[model samples]
Target: MRWKHIVAASLVLASLSGCSWVNKLVYRIDINQGNYIDQTAVEELKFGMTKEQVKFLLGPPMLVESGYPNTWYFVQYLKPGHDAPEQKELILSFDNSGQLVGMKGDYQPGSGFFEAVR
Candidate 1:
């Protein structure tokens, strides 16, 4: 009778644990958002590249503010990580003459020197 009671209790516990709501407790995933631009890609950008050239090199800006037409923004964001999301951005500004004159972001603009891999 004790063995039967023990078996019944174990089955009840197991069934309860297998409930649909319990699935969420074990399965979790991280989300990655926005463009993941490579530093090398941005390095290829020169001081006076045209908008078409810039788009070809870096793809379209992930977010474009309608109010600021000349300023382009590229952003990368990751979510739900142990550390802060691997977030970074690059902002490029163009002159009325349509030449790139400014770059401001977490990354430094290239000095046109390639790093030696050796």
Candidate 2:
């Protein structure tokens, strides 16, 4: 009889442990909001594009390069899960000449800001 009680208690503990594991998995973080800009549209911007043109094409950048009126930066981020590293950042830079100079961060052409151009 004592062995039966022990077995039942063990089963209960085992079930609770399984539930905790499942809870951890189910409770994972989900990032639903953040700027989802198209990078391709940003890339398509030519060196000669005016600031107005850039604004029309990519919308306002997430953050502009500090103290650099001629430079512009576009950024975006995605944080999907707690265990999963946050997928973050897309950066596009334009030079003082009003031309695209450097681009870094995740540049998914179709997935990013350039989709609207076509």
RMSD of each: 6.5, 5.6
The local lDDT score (0 to 100) that residue 31 gets in candidate 2 is: 64
Best by TM-score: 1
Best candidate, lDDT-wise?
Answer: 1
Which 10-residue span in candidate 1 carries the lowest summed lDDT? 109-118
Clashes of each: 0, 9
lDDT of each: 0.78, 0.61
Q: Once model 2 is optimally superposed onto the true structure by TM-score, how far is the C-alpha of residue 42 displaced, in angstroms?
A: 3.9
User: Each model's TM-score?
Assistant: 0.66, 0.55
lDDT tens readout by residue for model 2, 1-118: 9999999999999987776566566655666444566656745655445678878877876676568766555545455655553554655566656655445666544333343332
lDDT of 1 at 82: 39
